[model samples]
Target: MSTIENLLPEELLETLRDRAPGYDEENSFFHRDLADLKKLGYLQMLVPTEFGGRGFTLAQASQAQRRLAQAAPATALGINMHHVILGMAYTLWLRGDQRLNWVFEEAMAGEIFAFGISEAGNDAVLFDSVSTARRVTEGYRISGTKIFTSLSPVWTRLMVHAQVEGEDTLVFGFLEREAEGITIKDDWDTLGMRASQSCTTILDEVPLNTERVATHTPLGPNPDPVVWGIFGTFELLLASVYTGIGERAVSLACEIVAKRRSHVKQAPYAHDPDIRWQIASAGILMDGVILQLEKLTADVDALGTDRDPNYGAQWFLHFSGVKGRATEAAKEAVELAVRTTGGAQYFRSSELQRLYRDVLAGLYHPSDNESLHAAYAKALLGPAS
Candidate 1:
């Protein structure tokens, strides 16, 4: 099995890294990177082998994602939307559910999927949604606005969810990006991760034919495989990207320190005990983050969905903790890198500065620091009396 180091061509990563600054500077999408990834068959990496795809396991894909983030965090994050969709489908398929097999078949045929689950003030996560899926003559008419719709510029299909009006059902469906009444607002300007183009998507009575509806389950907690699949794949992959960013930051710090000479000591900064210590600390933290992510991913791929009934909740707790820790590690590593590199790294052009800004975004994803801690506490200590 090819390791993450060799999963993607080195030259491609170099090219993407070289172009990342320009894309960020102009707040443009990484169209070139996306096109290259498509040409390389990365878009269909999760499809089953029978469907002529690489059929990569979740562990393999997560490793590749971490590697990809080392070069370009925004690009890795944007492409993650597609991977999460395919990963979810693959997870379900492994559990003997063929309902989502068509997603793989479509992916192999060159369809790109985008995630459209986030909404304004929807803190219930997957259990509830503000969007309404009104019953229609043919299927359902979905009307809601979704935020953080990553890969908005190029996704061919949007996987979304909405509550059925006057019912206890939450419908999951895939709508074509070009379908009528679907408007994509190009308003994704942010503090970092600019190239992702995760714009706001407004669905105004978007129609979903009977054939397009994927799944319908009662709202709130349930024993649905799709829910577990989404939670497992999304959290792990998100953590992987931030972990990659952390890895890159530490390497850059080491490179910067190795070339500088301390005139007073008449020696390279690399020989300075303080600089060495800082780098060592960052490396140790990053290593822990990477190992945790790898082990969890391996477990998921190995166990599939046939484990104990409590596996889902326990797995989520683990994932939430890892995601929070990985993001924090990446942020700390980037901060240390800036300190090691001196004042010059504060410039807008500095890669470390970009990483610093990018790492802050981790605090905003699902299972935020507070939520993760709450969940962990609830899991271990039980809910407050």
Candidate 2:
């Protein structure tokens, strides 16, 4: 029952906030932040207590992520990759699946896991993979280039997926960082979320042990736990981060207006009707986003062990919908804050300026606008004629 208030206090948040700009400016990973988080046992928040973790639920993780993102969006996002994997394993484990118990054991032993699923031009997402997995003596040899490999600088274990060659199946498993044929290109410079160090990873026949393979399902989406686990945890965690950004933007906006005076009446902009209107609009959007996020997470939590794995479409519909709405609301909130803050937010020194840049990354994550619309269309209108 370690709440975010106890785990990430105001002092720690201020420290993270202080270092965020420096990390962004240097395009460096959040080494110090990562260290502090590890020390706090934040990395094992999702693993069960018996397994040496805090045993927090997905809902708690979402709330904690929101608080963390409010201080440092990039740092929150970088660690989110680790959380997503752990959350996925834990979500399935809760439903009586023991396939990923090793994940918890390794996490308890202090091993860091990074996600390596995203590929260039692979819009099939979890349903398919452009990367090829050739069957070898014992396990499959994964050979493909993965993009947006976050935590590239320090990940100890990487979870990846690839399409098996000559077979209509997809293979998912882990690869050791020290394993051969794994290359991490030092080219993570980006417009925002720079501290994440989400670089490109090239695998040249990296061997994956058969024992480590988590899923070997058919080529397309199915009623497997892996699909729902990944989609549910990824979408909820992603939504939480953007919602945090929106909350912080409004908070900063309020601070900015309270200090700046209106030239027309020499009164603080907080007293101006138009300024209030803008803040109110952003507040309204954020409120709705938070409600949607909470409802979705709660529903996932309440799902019984007998939950139907076949109910994948409804799951995708809600998860992607919330993620899309959260990102859109966050972007609008940031823009509104910038407009109210006037020229001050235009400077690189301003946190709002950084948030404005960082919020743009949300649109590029999984379930993009196009994907969101497509999911909604398929859900409401049935498959296209």
Candidate 3:
């Protein structure tokens, strides 16, 4: 019954916006923001109503993330990892796999989950992993270094995947924070999204209990539910954050141009044709991104409910396209705002400066521009000969 507005009211957003600069300047985690959001039960917003959560669909959650990002992109991005995990579990559940039901239950109990899927040099992503998963008497002992492990400060559980030793299998499992053999490095310095504290995690023979193991699939592209769930939820939510950044940039541009006076013209810069063109162009780019995101998220919700047998065959094309487009749009829109806003935005004190840095981080996320184009090309030309 909780609406997105109720969960993230304007007052909270204003507070987050006020604190954003300090957090970025200090390069510290968004502990206060996380605490406030926790109090609102925002962390468990995706759990179904039967499980004592708001029972929000992915579409609704994506919209909420966009609003949150508009206030503080770093906080929204840091929390997005947890939501991505929840979304994946819900996606799989809707598809009739109950293996991740415990995820929702644990979320209800206030257990925060972090994503540990990225490896230092592993470009294959979900289809392959550089980490090794060795068979043990009880279950599996995974040993490798995971990079970009967001929510490193407060996660109670981490979802990780690794390639099985001497086999063509990739295993997915959850590792507890209290479990031995997990080391979190203190190095998380970055150009943007600093509040995320996405530190590098070293896993030295960490034990995954039998019940903790979630999925086992052959290496490389496959029709596994785990892969589908992660890709769908992650790409959509990540795109939503960048889209929010674009929204913020465009909004600020409008405010600045309307108030900023052009001495020569003796009027607000909004009357200038060039400035109007830049702002309008930004709006045009954002419009396409919003439409793409809405359509894709709605399709995901429908697919989850109806069990479409062929719904996901070419999903990579759409998912990667949205993320690529959104990131590019955010960056371009932020640049437009910066150029039109004049010299003030170049200073570190300017909020637009922080946005520029944060928007840059989107370029490094998975499904980068190259991958996006590749997906589209593959869809048209087939795999490389």
Candidate 2 wrongly placed segments (more than 4 Å): 305-312
Best by TM-score: 3
Model 3, 116-148: lDDT tens per residue?
A: 999977888989999999999999999999999
lDDT of 1 by residue, 1-385 (tens): 3345555889989999999999989999999999988887888878888888887888889889988999999999999999999998988887778888999989988999999998999876777899999998989999999999999999999988999999988998899977899999989999999999999999999988888887788887665778778877889999999999999999999888888888899988899888888888899999999899888887877653554244656777887788889999888888888888778789998999999988888888887888788888887899899
C-alpha lDDT of all candidate models, in order? 0.87, 0.91, 0.92
Tell me the lDDT of model 2 at 88: 89
Candidate 3: regions farther than 4 A off: 304-310
TM-score of 3: 0.98
Candidate 2, residue 179: lDDT: 91
Error of 1 at 82 (Å): 0.3
Q: lDDT for model 3, on a 0 to 1 scale?
A: 0.92
Per-model root-mean-square deviation over C-alphas = 1.8, 1.5, 1.2
